[model samples]
Target: MRVTGLASGIDIDEQVKKMMAAKRVPMDKMSQNKQLLEWRRESYRELNSAIADFRYNKLDKFRLANATNVFSSTVTGNKTAVTAEATLTANQVDMKVRVEKLATQTTATSPALADSTTSKTKLSELGAVGNADGKVILEVSRGTGTPIKLEFSKDDTIQSVLSKINANTDAKLNASFDEASKKLIIKSKDYGADPFTLNGEFDTGIMKTKTPEGNLQIGEPAKVFINGKEHNPAQNEMTINGVKLAFLEESGNEESVITTRPDGNNLIGTIKNFVASYNNLINTLNSKVGEQKYKDFPPLTSEQREKMNEDDIKKWEAKAKSGTLKNDGIINGALLQMRSLLWDTSTKVGNKNLDLSSIGITTGEYTEKGKLYIDEEKLQQAINNNPDEIAAMFGGTKEKDGLFQRMYDRLLTPLTSISNKAGTSRYSADPTLSFNEQSIMGKELTDLNSRMAAFSKKLKTTEDSFYRQFNAMERAINKFNMQSASLANFAGQ
Candidate 1:
């Protein structure tokens, strides 16, 4: 315990506290600087997240031909027999579809039991004889592949056998027991014409496979005719010429006609969304770079925060966080590149040079900072006149000269630069994941932390020294007072 101010009547403890507070000024500044750096890193990460969302979700899809050239199909005649869907590459022509046969799965059933039994009934009770070791082995085969062998004790219940068969994915089989029919039924999980066989002691005892035809039924492939050309697919669905056709039922002699047409609404909506998202992203970047910094407001120290209410702290922090990304070179450079790319006239749609202006998309006033403005009526006219050109302009051909491709490629530069500086993970979808400590900003934080630690140690030593000096001074004053009292007593004697 410290006993001060008793001898000299000077509040040494308070004086020492005041001295330490002044000594801590540099430490508080370091704290504020560290906090500011953290805020800037957070801001960069937020921008990275926004850019990733735009690149992956919007630009990736918009650059695809399918997204810009959406197609819808309609079935006219025998619609119930077949359904069709068309892709961007599909030919806009009518196709006749006739489904002669629907696909079926291979199935097998055991002969009725001598007595009614539930799944819980023991196999032995159902007359299932086991081997000498009292174990029944069931071998199941699908197609010409190797058979799956399942062994169970005769004492096991029928449910156990069914569960084992159903759980074996490699078997590709499903097994069940019917209580009312007193029979065991099994079938291939896949729809195909492939042969399925069951051969084992259990089959003889429970499945009664002695007369194979009476117990087993083979599956049939789906027989369909597209434009009078026959196709025998193992499944009911087939894709031809980029058009997917799914056979619902046999049409006998009747034929269903599938017609394809361009879907304008979907294409227009996609373009509109792209424009809106582009504007939103650029606006956010612009605001961040142009935001005003409050020079008077620095990050609060712990001591300062302790003295203020929550509302006051929040308002102060708002000013402190403003313009963390002001005039960032990487962000400003990206904005300029994006604006230039959109205005590039070198992109060609066929023989004609195509640009955003050709499709009613143009930049707003200079004050808007490259925000896009779309003329809807003119855009609709352009789409109506030559939708293929519009699709090629946005999605491009194999040449990759389209606007979406250009924008997507341009975005990569900034994204990479930001990730390198801010330590944001480029591969991960999550922005809040731990920063890479080797990044530029991360290294800066590491240095700050090291310096702060060293300074803190030094501050500790200084505080201890101040307390020791005060203690010595107090002792000296106490000794002097004791000597004065002794002299007065001697003189009186």
Candidate 2:
């Protein structure tokens, strides 16, 4: 610690501050550069997010082309007996359906056993006395699946045997014996054509003693005839000519007439929604491209910001960040390309006359910056007259992509270029991006920061060395003045 001045009588600390202020100019510039890079990076990512929103949320949905959600069908003739659903590939169909027989499951009931509440009352006690080689093996199977077997002996209790069967069947079937009725009941797990069967062997004594035998019940397939054609569906449901038919019961001679046709109302709604989404995104992108840059408002230095209050600093930053992406080549280029694509035509999906204009979609005036506006009446006409063409316009082939696909492709190149320059949130996990080590601006910022840190360290050293030199100079001056004063006193004496 050295005194500021004893003989020099000057504030060395204040002077050092002024000298360092001059030295910090380059450091402040580096800091400003870093901030500007951060702002530019943020701008690129924001634009990318908007692009992604349009591509995934809006464009990807064109795969269906509003057939499932829009242009739905309503069947009037067979409302209760036969129902139908509309799909993307659904064509108009009207047919007669007659269901002759519905499918049914198999069931079997065992003989009653009269016994007391004792484990000693086994299958042998229940009139099923088995010989030495008399073991009852029950195998239950469904369809082509391997049969599951449950084996029992004459010594086994009826309750124990029933518990084993219940535990082993999984969910395929149920086996239960009522306590009051003393009758063992077995039933199939499912209905329809599946043959739910019970084929197993029983001892002679049990087979002879039981009243209503434990023979297996056979299952039956559903008999359905649609439009005079026999449809023996394994299950009760069948899909034919884009219409699903489910059998509720035997309809006998009562014929169900089903009619399917495209409804235009739903198709128009989704088209309008698409147009509005496109307009919103295009307007935002156009405004960004045309946004004016405030060149006079350079980034604030740390020292300069410290002199101002928080609100003033915030205000200054807002102005400083006004046009980070304005006139940027990648972003503006992407905008122009997307706008051009919106005007372009594709032949892969919609052939000739499949352009947006054919379906009543058109661009706005010159001042509107390529915003799409739909003609509702014309759009409805196109939907009603030929919705297939409209669908093809939205969902085109890969080689000659449709309207949405073309727009989506247009943004991909520019988005990639911008991402390479500024990086993205996906790159935040990368050490090179997070530490500003690899990307275009990131590498530049990293070098600037390194130089600033070194410069700051040199400044600190220069400041300390200057303060020590000034202190030494002050001591030398004070000693010389003392010598001069002593000589003057001696001369006067």
Candidate 3:
């Protein structure tokens, strides 16, 4: 409906080309904005993940010696089972214990194939001598002795088959069933005892059989020793080495407290964490910066336009991009550190020999924010220079100020405090709004975290979509530009 770029007397091709050129800018703008949003979202994810990791790392591990309410495995009939501990530690004392037991097992056998040739047939075509609803009589032959007759009922299931077989047999042959394959098979007590067979015909058309798989026993209860001291073992309580621990089966139960073991090097984790995190951020950003628009779609939703605007999206994109010539000391220092090698050359390299630079981490040019990139080279240097620092940067290697540490302090402290509060009871027909300082603050922090996460995700998706659209627009514009020039040439001719 609108016509402005092309002259009124211009060729129709020229007009089309002009229209395309005009559309290009808006599409590009949309793509750029979308990419910015994606980056922001990814940043948010990295930040949140760091925070969660920090909080969990703060929880120190303890041995089963510190566990509570440990029960005895002997209560059910386990003799070899020793006292188990819930915590991971080196000392222990008196503690309660419990026995772990399982239900009894049963077994049943099927009639042997009369042909002895050992041919297989479909269940539908299988010859029958047993009824579907009644018990079937099967003759079990071990060696050359008179065969033992065993009766199996329809009520018997695969789980109970083993117990049933043991009850009826002193012979060496074992009877088993496979539920999954639906086949009846027999095995000899000793190896190479071939030709052990069962003789019985299925009376009903359904001659299908089943086999069962075996499972290992659950480990004995863990031990618990509290405060470098000893305590009686109770259910879920244990003393491992010398740490006190308890395994509360229920969620949010104060009684179910268990100490965790500490992994050395929090700082390294902090830094490398950002690597994975930043990669995710890049993915989100790429999507937004070049997304395609749904031509027929409506304008932005009300919520979409509220927190983020077109301009805000642009600003974020600018921040994400580094100028080719510009540099920041913090980012640069991090990069320089990454490039340097810390460990000496050694043929006997293990976890200690593992340097940061060995990986593809280096510094390079980043156009989006005009900042130096930690490309393969710089990345490796940074990792090699001080692997611990790099890891700590990403919330690894266990530092208090790492990304995860900050995130955890910012997000979880208030939440836990509020959740722990014992609030006053309010009695009213309509719920009275009595806001506790701790509760309110906790809720606020939680809300902020949720909002930030959602916003980041939305922004990333939008930007990614925008970039795709932008690429399409660029192609269209290029095509139109060529067409416009071609038209002018044609008109001249």
Candidate with the greatest lDDT versus the true structure: 1
- What lDDT tens digits, residue by residue, belong to model 2 across residues 1-493? 6568778988888888898888888878878888888887777777766776776677667445442233354555445655666554666666678778777666666555554534345776766643356876666666687777767887787668767776774536666666776666666666654555555553233322223455446557788777788887766777777666676767655777766666666666666766787788777777777777888888998778779999998888888998888877887787778767766753334344556776778887899978778888887776677665565566653344566666766667876676668665332222233422477877777788888889889989989988988888898999999999999999999
lDDT of each: 0.84, 0.68, 0.38
From the highest TM-score down, the ranking of the candidates is 1, 2, 3
Q: List runs of model 3 lying over 4 Å from the truth.
A: 1-28, 46-133, 136-160, 163-493
Top TM-score model: 1
Candidate 1 stretches with Cα past 4 Å from truth are 56-69, 112-125, 131-135, 142-145, 148-169, 174-185, 189-192, 209-214, 333-348, 380-389, 392-416, 429-432
Rank order (by lDDT, best first): 1, 2, 3
lDDT of candidate 1 over 94-205, digit per residue (tens):
8899888898888888887757588789888987888887889888876668888989888888899899989988778889988788888888887777767888878878
Model 1 lDDT, residue 196, Cα: 76
305-356, model 3: which lDDT tens digit per residue?
A: 5778789655543544423113323223322332231122111134554333
What's model 2's overall lDDT? Answer: 0.68
Candidate 3: minimum summed lDDT over ten consecutive residues — where? 60-69
Model 2 shows how many backbone clashes? 0
